[model samples]
Target: MPRGFYTEGSLARLSREFDVFGPLSSDPEPWMTAELDQHAAAVCESITRDAGAVTLQNLSSYLQGFVDGCRERGWRSDSAGYDWETLRLLAVCRLAKEHGFVR
Candidate 1:
């Protein structure tokens, strides 16, 4: 992700449940690794927030589409690395679920 492409404002609501780490920068330094994990955890938590209310079959289907979208967008590329891609995918999944665009 580009610097400032995702801002603290985008994650304001998530701050209550998880640390609001800024998005990956254009030339992200190694120090950002910790924040990346935090961001991913937040996204995962948010995406799974309604897990109990959602059917396993539906959740699995949604998850497949979510991961496929990420891969199609190159969010899962080796260039982005495992951690970065993990966070990116989780974040997108969370946002999609929030908007009712995904399960």
Candidate 2:
């Protein structure tokens, strides 16, 4: 599938657009929310501590677990679930890119 098929533009655009929908309150889906935050934090910490070794590929590999987890939670056929996962991953990747983990 082509990129942006999920929405229309970039993940950043989708994130901004999602905000108009409403605030994302805490839900029972820990794997989709808090788990994503924790994973992002851990990835950032690792990247900061070892910038030389933490590449985008490394970050991507780590993120795959989160993606898989999200899929298990409900990302398969749900647009909302896909959006949440995409938003979380984009935020994490953006941070990694800023820290030089990605080009």
Candidate 3:
């Protein structure tokens, strides 16, 4: 599969499993919400140690997971409430392109 497609599929799978909705709704599916929260915490921890540790591979997986989680929960990217996942995904995409991971 193409890189973009692969990335998107990975993201979708993670999203479905995690049930991450956008920032709009406070209540997401219990299981996924908790898992996503944990993932976010891990990401934050990783960032504090070394920003460079956030490589293309790691960012790609993280962004995909966030996007998929949000999408599965029926959250809109444009919603005014919460879009941290969406924005994070965009940042990762840019980094991936800069690193030649995509295209």
Candidate 4:
């Protein structure tokens, strides 16, 4: 179980409830880790396909929210611990760059 699993789950839930990326009719937790992996791949593809279309603002907001949410959940932001939140943000950033969301 990767640490980002929790963050991915939470983001998926948020996306579903708010229709951020449209409706997600699947179990987010069980699929979170996999989803993150897929998201990273998608981003890379999008970058190679069309760099101009990639949107970093939205991705940054999402990552910021994820970090804040994890902090609210009692995860320390200044440590190298293998906590769920920390891992999630790290993965999110990686994906964001792969997708051309971040530079």
Candidate 5:
């Protein structure tokens, strides 16, 4: 699938567009929404410290390069129950890109 497929909209909107509508389908599952704000704050701090800022100009390359680097650490963001920090990082990035790559 195209990268746009992942970042075009909130999950619910996508599901609806594809004819997969239901109450259980939404922007994020309840568990993620509960902690997303905190995770976003942490990601902002981390991105700021490491690369100054994660702007649209660099978001794609940053994500690509970060994924490469993560391979060394097992790249288990989607593994089993999921690693919260890694999962949050991706969630945060997806949301950032979804929102037009806001800095």
Candidate 6:
């Protein structure tokens, strides 16, 4: 299995750090070395298709749009919180590299 692209960019590091240090901390170590999951991959595909292409130059904008959309509806319920925010960052980084957007 291939691992996701590991960019040394601030966005990538932010995701990993948030995942490891956030209140709902998760083990991103496995995600770092493992193949991208189907769900994330599928989301990435849809985003790429819908957005017409995501590159490092615009990744942050996409991230902002995601957060804005989430906030527009509801980012949290009783069961979940901001974990999806961090996960989306990680997922975007993963596919960004996979799609050669990170270079």
RMSD of each: 12.9, 7.8, 11.7, 12.5, 7.2, 8.4
**Which digits, one per residue and each the tens of the lDDT, describe model 3 over residues 1-103?**
1112222455334233222333212455665455555655566566546555656567655676666787798855544432455435433443444455554
Per-residue lDDT tens digits of candidate 2, residues 1-103? 1233333334344334433331332232555556556756766676567564656566655566666687677664234444555656555645554555444
How many backbone clashes does every candidate have? 0, 0, 4, 1, 0, 0
All models: lDDT? 0.44, 0.51, 0.48, 0.47, 0.49, 0.51
Name the top lDDT candidate. 6
Q: List the residue pairs that clash in candidate 1.
A: none
Worst 10 residues of 6 by lDDT: 1-10
So what's the TM-score on candidate 1? 0.31
Assess candidate 6 and give its lDDT.
0.51
- Listed in order, each prediction's TM-score against the native is 0.31, 0.41, 0.37, 0.44, 0.49, 0.46
Off by more than 4 A, model 4: 1-54
User: What is the Cα-based TM-score of model 5?
Assistant: 0.49
Number of the candidate with higher TM-score, 2 or 3: 2
Instruction: State the weakest 10-residue window (summed lDDT) of model 2.
Output: 1-10
Give the alpha carbon lDDT tens digit for every residue of 3-89 in model 4: 223333443343332222211233346456575566555544555464444455555555666567767878654453434544355
Per-residue lDDT for 15-60 in model 5, tens only?
3322222121347667756566676666667667877876654445
lDDT comparing candidate 2 with the true structure:
0.51
Model 1 over residues 1-103: C-alpha lDDT tens digits? 2222222222223222222233322334565555555764565575468564443344444456655676677653333333655455444434444555433
RMSD of 4: 12.5
Over 4 Å off, model 3: 1-7, 10-52, 76-85
In angstroms, give how far residue 60 of model 4 lies from its true place. Answer: 0.9
Q: After superposition, how far is residue 74 of candidate 2 from its true place, in Å?
A: 1.9
**The 10-residue segment with the lowest total lDDT in model 4:** 16-25
lDDT of 5 at 31: 70
